[model samples]
Target: MQEPPLRELRCDVAVIGAGTAGMAAYRAAREAGARAVLIEAGPGGSTCARVGCMPSKLLITAAKAAHDARRAGEFGVATGPIRVDGVATLQRVRRERDRFVAGVLSEFEKFPNEDRVNGRARFVARDILVLEDRDTRIAFGAAVIAAGSSPAVPELLAGLGDRVLTTDTLFEIPDLPRSLAVIGGGPVGIEIAQAMARLGVAVTLLDGGHALAGLRDPDLVARANALFAAEMTLHFGTKVERAESAGDGIRLTWAGKDGAGGSGVFDRVLAAAGRPPSLRGLGLEEAGLSLDEKGGPCFDPRTLMGEGAPIFVAGDAAASRPVLHEAARQGRIAGRNAAALVRSGPTGIATPAPWVNLAMVFTDPGTAAVGETYDPERAAERVVGAVDFSRQGRARIMDRAAGALRIYADRAGCLTGAEMLCPEAEHLGHLLAMAIQDGQTAQDLRDRPFYHPTVEEGLVTALTRIIDGLDAR
Candidate 1:
């Protein structure tokens, strides 16, 4: 059978972004027997699979290797000067990213019910979308907004031009900076700072607020700070007064704690301050959707629906904190729930579940958390226990003693949250997420047999400490 022409094309579900969340939703919709289509504004690639997560992790891997080589002297192995070919390394990173994205695109092409449209999509009506390239309009029974975010660039520093780069553009620079100043201490900023410092860049990390504010645990912050202090210069609770063009670099003036001022010259400056969801050009308002106070689409969390019927929001486009994993999870639920509502009615399937077990991964020493941290005043009084990775034998063997594991539980012993800082923290994060999501107690994990002499043993030890402390209490 021959497919209909592009002009007459329509789908059961239309997803407006082809990033992680959009791809997940497209796949889910196909699995649920809906004809699905994905639209991407990016240049046939995704931020995560391209310049965002994948390239950043590649840089981190090279940095880690260099760091380990420098420490090889501890094992009585003599080494000469360490060299990093930044340009060549970046080329290799791009090649790897291209290959990965190609593989993903190939797999997506295998879906019989799914189609990929390469262009920007804007809402033409409640059920209609207009593609940018041709005069093509698509109508669908349901639509998902998964458009992800782009780096936020301050207008004041726009004059720096190529000298100042956002996360998306920084990786494309031809040469590595001899001295780099990162203007934000969030995950992207700190991760890039440490990775560059390890690669022999004189790196400085500046944050307007206390660094890592999302991390509520002071001990985890202290441990991360110690590692960063050894690797790079850190300026916290500071604001950039101005940035001026210099001979070959740029000069930055900043004010620090209690009106203290300082100046620095840097070869390059990366603005990793944050990202705002890509909401423009979507004609959201034209479709009757109103922006929330934070300037995102107002959504009903229960239905993932926008102001009007049949239009749903998901991923970064929705009024939710942006994270790749969370976006994908929400996209799956939203896609499924959207299909159910359109197919069998609102009661066909339960409402999309609220997000939980959101995990964040920072490459250096890594970190992962689920549920909520225990704050005496902020959180209902609960039982909390934290154990240092220095006490874990596996961490000792790995020579990574700078880590922490924490668990939070209620009076009934049901686990509420777990956080870990160690090698494979991302992997361990999922395990902890399961415990929190399933309402399992710390004792339940402690009693479960784990493989001996592995990183997982740290979890067992941490859980045991929680059990012992509870017994003593």
Candidate 2:
């Protein structure tokens, strides 16, 4: 039998991966008068909108609600034993996730300048791509590799059977296990362990390094540790040697902080050991593109163009540390630059603004920070401001007094970084990130009026402290 003919199509920009970044880039390209085509690996949506961020957050909220209900008596509310229907809660989360994904798909369908293709895409050349749908082949023009990363499952524990689950497959679990051993101390592992523990599952979180190492604030890390300690067992400085299936559970052999070998058995083993960018079989080498040491496509920082101007990379596939917000920002920039390249022919600079702000959202007491952490060696003088949540009226009222807001600036008052571990830390962190990215000083945040009695009001108070300390000096 003869092979099917390749379907040829032309567009000003071709965005591969329909995740947050791909969608943003597609829309931006269309707005810039470029006909865009969006290609996705799975379906039309992404794990972020479907199972990753949205569903996981919903499950976390449900878990938190169940936990609060059990403690209602302490808040002067008479309540019986807290009950949680894990299956029903999961169903609701999936439903909402589906709706959100469908809404995004609907928006893509409505765009006249954007074409959505469902298939696995590989490079035919630098600028050309061949998308495979079973036996059909479709080609495109300029390509954007937004192919995001997947849950990193270590090779040592790969042979473990059904008991082993990654973040992508955790939501599909038939029922909540009696005990869960979460391997990895990063955001995904911590969040999953905490969520499951709150849902009444006995959880043990093991991380090779200290937990929340990226937070860079000892006090914030301690606060998170204390909060997590109330529910789950956290084993820091623990390395997983291997995993084997036991009778009804899985046995994990690990090295403890003292370098002693220890064993743990759990009903299920969740591998939350971060992610590796999805770059396999994408023909990157055929297109003369190479990945960095961090497993992301190598690209010029100024242009974000890898190998050639016709091929661009963004999102998780391009970034060393792929955060959703950063991916979207890079995607928009890449899309605009790609369109500009196609329109104006050869250009030196693709986009003027590069991705600068990176934010991470943790459920409940989340955190956000931008720019570099204060380094004594790199600074002539450093100014640090901090205010405990216990002093914040809203935090006290909300009964969440574990976190704080801290800001770091230079002697000249340029915002270097800010960390908020409050109830609304995630949102408040964005404000700080914007300020720092915009080169705003502590006075800018101090002068901004926050809503009365809100968690964000703590920002103003924290900045006031920084200003006062400066004046006193």
Candidate 3:
């Protein structure tokens, strides 16, 4: 069964990139009765291991400890002065991050196929990929673009070099900044802003909207904004007018909501803006793959298949949802479907069913939303269920409650979504998200047993309210 070395490296599937989605796709494709060639030009470890989820969470975990120690007094638990070792903390983050990455790399090395192609990949024909530098050609029956994305910095903010930081490079810095100004006050920005501020960095968050972390629910937005306003200097409805080097620091000028301008000289300016789909040098047109208005591969959302082509788009490369979990789902589904296509079959999925949208911002009083965000147009038809954590017994016991939760439901009583600015919202968010994903109704959610004296109790209270609203209608 051995083949000649000097021929087309053809396979049932060819997967691009080696990030979270790419790896998942590769594994799933293997299980789906296909051999795959995973192509990457750089280290093929999970992106989350290197620069994303895991590392950021590690940094936040350290910040949370330092933060919690400082606020221990509210619970009559007196603690000594807290001093965070920024150098040591960063060392731990990198060490753990590297360990996670190493594990992924090791797993990759053990992959049975060992059909990895190292070098730039470009489409020379509809189903033909050429490794330009290596002069290797691969004709895959089905190809997947799990190519990952990178943090997007505006062209206007380019050339700042070391003065500006992105999430991808933020953890690389050896030391924390004395002062920081965060651009694009979204989830990533707010998380880093608050975590650093808690770790003792003076922080200023300049966001596009009046809301903190883009809360669509007006009431939740106001509450979350008020919470963050007390900690960091906030300039909402503002845009960065100028960013320039000022001596050893960076000077930023922003135009505020009132048309008034504000300026600050900071030790660093971090951009947690957004991720652009990685499409550079891909030569997708050579594969007969067309691009959508979003500048991504035009693919069927359900099967991730390119329009009448053998290419399936997955993960950040497609820029759909842009969350790790969503990317994972895309990769698995796309991997299975791509293999099926290679077998001359359809995936049996026509229209893509939307997953429950779950977004979380890790801050002191975390911000989270699942599924539907509040829209004024549909506000009247939806039933609202709410609970203020500030009044919850468990929250009062912990002395850390300072936010609210609002759950929305359809007229048929199915739990649609929730927006919350609450303590331990990350946990609360997952629970609500799972409920929505499982198609649980208000009564069904209420039927779930609740233990006394816990955050789950708070959710129960909210569910009861929704049930009442359902009964009234």
Please give the CA lDDT of all the candidate structures. 0.78, 0.76, 0.85
Tens-digit lDDT string for candidate 1 (1-473): 97545564688888888877788888777788888888878764566776687888888888898899998887788898889888887787777877877876776566553387777898878788887764678888888888888888777678887889887887788868899999988878888888899988999888887745255577777777777788889888899989999998989999987788788999999998887888888887766777778657877876677766577787767646567777777788778866776788767645745656566766568888778864658445567666777777777777776678888877666778876667778877888888777778988877777987878887776677667767776
- Model 2 clash pairs? none
**What lDDT does candidate 1 reach at residue 370?**
78
lDDT (tens digit, per residue) of candidate 3 on 1-473? 97545446989999988888888898888998898888887766776788888888998999989988988987788998999888998999999999998998887777665577777788888888888574688889888898888888866668778878898889988988899999878888888888888889999998887877768887788888888888889988898988888899989988977888899999988888877877888888788888777656788777788985788888888876778898989998888888888775664434458689998888778888899978789988888899998899888888777889999999988889999888889999999999999999989988988889898788898989988987887
Runs of candidate 3 exceeding 4 Å displacement: 1-7, 347-352
TM-score of each: 0.92, 0.92, 0.95
**Tens-place lDDT digits, model 2, residues 74-96:** 78998887777878877787788
Q: List the residue pairs that clash in candidate 3.
A: none
Shift in Å, residue 271, candidate 1: 1.1
Candidate 2, lDDT over the whole model:
0.76
Per-candidate alpha-carbon RMSD to the true structure: 3.6, 2.5, 3.0
